[model samples]
Target chain A: MKIGFIGTGKMGYPMAQNLLASGKELFIYNRTKEKADPLAAFGAKILGCPKEVAASSDVVITMLANDEALLEITAGSEGLIHGLHEEGIHLSMSTVSPKVIQEIQSMHAAKNQILVSAPVFGRPDAAARKELWIITAGPLEAVRKCHPIFQALGRGYSNFGEEPARANIVKILGNFLIMTVIEALSESFSLAQRAKILPQDFLSAINQALFRSPLYENYGQLIVKKAFSEPGFTLQLGFKDATMARDLVESYRVPMPYLDVVYWRFLSALNHGKAELDFAAISSEVFDSWEDHPPLK
Target chain B: MKIGFIGTGKMGYPMAQNLLASGKELFIYNRTKEKADPLAAFGAKILGCPKEVAASSDVVITMLANDEALLEITAGSEGLIHGLHEEGIHLSMSTVSPKVIQEIQSMHAAKNQILVSAPVFGRPDAAARKELWIITAGPLEAVRKCHPIFQALGRGYSNFGEEPARANIVKILGNFLIMTVIEALSESFSLAQRAKILPQDFLSAINQALFRSPLYENYGQLIVKKAFSEPGFTLQLGFKDATMARDLVESYRVPMPYLDVVYWRFLSALNHGKAELDFAAISSEVFDSWEDHPPLK
Candidate 1:
């Protein structure tokens, strides 16, 4: 099947490259154009707009930055909706709101086209290595048709059934869980530092006894070393995900007290102009407030 | 060396049995003498009181309910402090506050006896299997003397160096981390339920993609099945640990917003007469609050 990929940013660039490496015939588009230009070296056809990429392929995948970008590229006058043929499929891999994807699915259905929500769980490095875990939802036929595409870019995939928006809710809640972990680590590590316990030693003890997970070990190391200079996932994106979670839960009338704390931490970090740093940098907010408090040793 | 085991409760019973099975000469005591009477079957000597237990053994291990019990048993007129010989060691394994342990340590030092904080991580089942993870801090020589005891009762141990209270701090922080996870799972599972997603499916997906830890999987299963009848770790004890964490961090001026959320969850669960249920029952509070709201789709 002919495939089209859009949004050649940090996560998208590597994902699209993997599609080409898997020997898929690919058409690519990026608003900046320059970002998409590099994929041509890997035998991908560079298109001028989302509509052009849509016209050239049977299945189009959009991995844009946020809700607005996703909506504009998929439904604008020059969007994919204006160019794809009947029975054409649009696989959305963006971390946008569930409501937006549900609305976009209706728009595609009006033209006899399909939209599938398949947000991923991994960073840019995971994307580059084709190890992203994809969570998908849409019509069974549409999802099955895109399996080859999922296989080309991800290590494995979980289908959340046919509503299409269920996948987005799962993705948002998953990100919320991760942020809570980061917040918990920050608070405990800060307390440990104040008590004069070495952060590394504290991490080793707790991880060995309780967690025994790479998620905690990696994030713990990042916070311990204050390694926020390199961005695996930016603080801005983390804030965006947190905002989406807050909005979604509010609409559902579900009380997520833990999300509120991490949401505030992300907002405070963003306001301090640390949006470009890794989201693990949220720990700095915990450590920074301890300037006046000396160790208890 | 002769060993004394105090507080023959759910955890202490199996731990004492392991020491006896390891061929140690065991002296046992409990507030209710009936609890310690059973250990006599395994070649243990049932003692009259904490004082008699301490007087007969070179080292004593206390695993009790709360800080009050720990302080009362160690410092009262007929307490271990009044009878432990000079150079004897007291190994505390209860989940109590660092301040209480430090104060008791000073009292032990004045009497020419040693105190070592050696709190543990595991439920009763783990204790029964000798699979607990012990965290220790005290004088080097005192800790070395307790190695055979640790090996008899635990899978492994991590020493936090001198200052017996440091081990208690690590233990409290570790419990705090576990509670944060319980709260996170509670909120996310609540949201998933309202969104027409099965709790088991949500748990499986997140555990596979993100956590991959038995800690999350076991607790997630408990929360999903609403199986809070059997207490692995009771909600009441969870509140005690949370309260200690709150008091400890406040004393250090470290803000732990996430802990504040879970702390409230534990308190709410306890007030609702859920003190005897598993701590994962904190999820019941989230689901109970949702009775007024209907599920979407």
Candidate 2:
């Protein structure tokens, strides 16, 4: 099978590498040429633009950073829709909004192509291990047609049926849950620490109790250790997902007061010039009010 | 050990019933005499007032509803302190605030008695199964001394150390997390339903995904089925916990924005007359918003 992988950044590189190692004819395109250079060792064809890549592959997978990049890359001369074979599928696995996915679907349909959204849930480390949980929504036949590359890129797939954008919505909401956990833990711990309980002790009890969520355990570790330099997902993206979630809520008239509070926290972190840090770093703002308090014994 | 258990409501009844079935010298007290009647058949000494119950027992366990009931029963003329003996252990296992626990502890201490705070986590069903996860904090010796009773009342006990009031805070925070999950799930479902996705589908994804905290799964059933009548904890208490959690945050100089949002959601439900309904009934407000539009399909 001829496959084309685009935007080989953090998540995309490993995914594209996996596809290349599958012994399929892999054509790659990247906004930055350096990312595509490494795959040439595996006999992967490096296409300079989307049009060239689309002309040569049976499938074009978009693993861009966010909605903006995805839209930018698809709306102009170098876009994915103009590059794919007439019958090819664009398996989009980026974290994006449902409306954006619907737009891509509409555009792709106009071009007589298919856009299958398959946003993934896993950190960069998980992606490197091929341990990511991938969710797809599109035609069942198209999903089946692209199984080999999907299997190569991810551990497993959850098909939410033919409206592929629904998968993107689910993925963003899932990310929203993670960020919500971070914000709640940060605020609660600051509260507990003020009440003379150690933040670590509070986290330990919560992690050990029925509220044992991976999001809590992982982000709680970062908050406890105060590690915010690097992240599985950057603070910027975390804020973006929160905004997307809030947007969806606004459109639906479902009040996201929790996300609203969290949105401001994200904005604080963004305004504080820590957008490049881990999303868990938002906990720092939570602890700001207690900066002068004696540490809990 | 001669033990006194005050309050025999849904939680108290099962917890006290479990204690009595364990072959302890148990004295039971309830505002209503009917509740204490059934336990009397099982070797319990049913008492009329908190004084009689405390006077006849070496250790008094307050499991009453609300901080008010607990305060009154323990502070009334026939209250726990009114009859407490020197060196008697006043073990409070109710869900309440840390300040209240500290207040009661000081009052009991001045009376030459030792108070231990041992707030529990688990639903009525868990209480019935005797599988409650008890978060205990108090003097090490006191918690150790009360181990047999603790074991009898729940699956196990986790010693959170010598600060008895800390356990009350832990229990409160745990409830806070459960409430966050409820609110998050409620809002997410509202968004999903507006987006024309099935509530059942969205809930199943949450249950199966990393967001699958037992809190979500349990509340997901309530929200999924829209079964909000016949309160277990009651939305009023949910509101109180939210307010208490908010007070805890503000006291410590931390702003709990998300919790504040959820607090008022419960408050709005209260204002809308959902005081007696299940806290899950807050979903009704979210459901009501989508009554006319018929979410986009």
Candidate 3:
């Protein structure tokens, strides 16, 4: 099968590389085209646009930026569907909203193309490890057909049965948890430093107890070392997902009062123009919450 | 060495039992006399109050609730100091504020009483396994004196050195991380369920990846079951620690905006009078955030 990848940004680039490294017949396209060169060196055939990639591939996987980009690539007249074969599959791994996934699923179904929501959880490093946990939802038959691709890009995959949006929802929820860890670690660590708690002791203690997770360890290491210069995941996306989650809950009359506060924090970062930095910069925001600390890194 | 045990409630009782079973000469006291009986049967001396326990032991171990109860036994004329010898050492294992630990240190100094902040990490069950992680910060000599007792109550103890509040601060930060996980799990699990994502699959998928940790396995079970009945650490104390963290941050002039949201979820549980329930009851708060599906028990 010829595999085409859309969105060659941070995660997409490495994922595409892994697919090509797996010796699969792979094609790639990026809106900027510049992102295609790195993968081209990895022997991936860089195509012109979404439609071209979609037309030649059996499965086109998307790891786009956000809802707008996802909608753009999947919904236009010359979008992915314009080129997909009736038996083709569109596997979306982007952390998108359920509604968007549902819409994409509906349109793909109309064209006799199958849409599979296969959102994976991992940072760029984790993705590089082929260690992402893929939560798949959509047609089970479609998912079965794409098992080889899932194996190419990730370590493990779980079938969420059908309902592709359900996979996206889980992805969003995972993001929500990540943000919460980032925020909580930021606040608590900052508090500890201010109170003169030794960092070696602090990190070792939390990591051993209720924490003891790579996500917490990953975020805690960054916060403890005050490393936010080059971000693996930008603050803007963190803010974006939180806002998406907040909308998801509120639109359905679900009262995510806590998420409402998290959304505001994300907006606050956007307001302060820290959106382009690492989400660990939320640590700086947390530090600012205290009256005594100067600011975050 | 003679061991003094104070605050025999849920946690203290088990911890004291573990110590007494280890064959130490135990002197026990609790605000309520009835709590003293179980241990009293095992060759443990049930002292009437803080003063009595202090006068009779070389080392006094306290495992009270919040900073208030912790202080009540360690402060004032009728407190631990009234009976502590010039050479006595007080080992504090309660989850109290770094500030309070500092205050206790000051009070202990006047009586030449050594204060060791040894806040523990792990639930009551873990405590019984002697599987709890104990963090110690105080004089090296004082820690040496309490090493035997630490061995009895926990699998191992890590020394933080000299500044006792630093250990308390580490404990607070650890709790902060736990709360962050709780709140995040609550939000994501609830949202995922509404989006047709089977929260179990969502959690399993995430937990299998970066989200995997004993913290998730333990607390995630509570949030997933919506069974907040077990009160290892009540929502009330959860809120207290969060606020304690917030207070430290605000006092330090740090900005912890994520906590603003978590505090409210905790407040929601508190508002609904679920403060006495398990901290995982924050699940309801997350459930309340989404309105599409009614809710799952």
* Model 1 residue A125 lDDT score: 91
lDDT of 2 by residue, B1-297 (tens): 899999888898988888878888998889998977998888898888899889999889998767888789888777889997898888898888778888888888889888888888777888988978788888888878899998898867766788887898888887887777777777777777777678788777755556546767778889889887877778887777777787677566666777776776786788898998987887777666665764463
Ranking by TM-score: 1, 2, 3
For model 1, what is the alpha-carbon lDDT of residue B246? 89
The 10-residue segment of model 3 chain A with minimum total lDDT is: A288-297
lDDT of 1 by residue, A1-297 (tens): 999898999999999999999999999989999988888999999988899999998999999889999999999989999989999999999999998998899999999999999999989998999989899999999999999998988878889999999999999999998998888898899899888899899999998898887788888999999999999999999999999998887788887888888887887898899999998988888788784667353
Over A9-128, each residue of candidate 2 has an lDDT whose tens digit, in order, gives 888888777777767888888989997898899888898888788778788888888888888777667787777767788888889888888898999899889888888888877787
Please name the candidate that would achieve the greatest TM-score relative to the true structure.
1
Tens-digit lDDT string for candidate 1 (B240-294): 8999998987788887888888877887888899999988888788888785667
Q: Tell me the alpha-carbon RMSD of every candidate.
A: 2.2, 3.0, 3.7
Q: How many residue pairs clash in all the candidates, one count each?
A: 0, 4, 24
The 10-residue segment with the lowest total lDDT in model 2 chain B: B206-215
Per-model TM against the reference: 0.95, 0.91, 0.88
Per-model chain A TM = 0.97, 0.93, 0.93
Best by DockQ: 1
Query: What DockQ does every candidate get?
Result: 0.55, 0.38, 0.49
Q: Who wins the lDDT comparison?
A: 1
lDDT of each: 0.91, 0.81, 0.80
Model 2 has a DockQ score of: 0.38
Compared with the true structure, model 3 gives a TM-score of 0.88
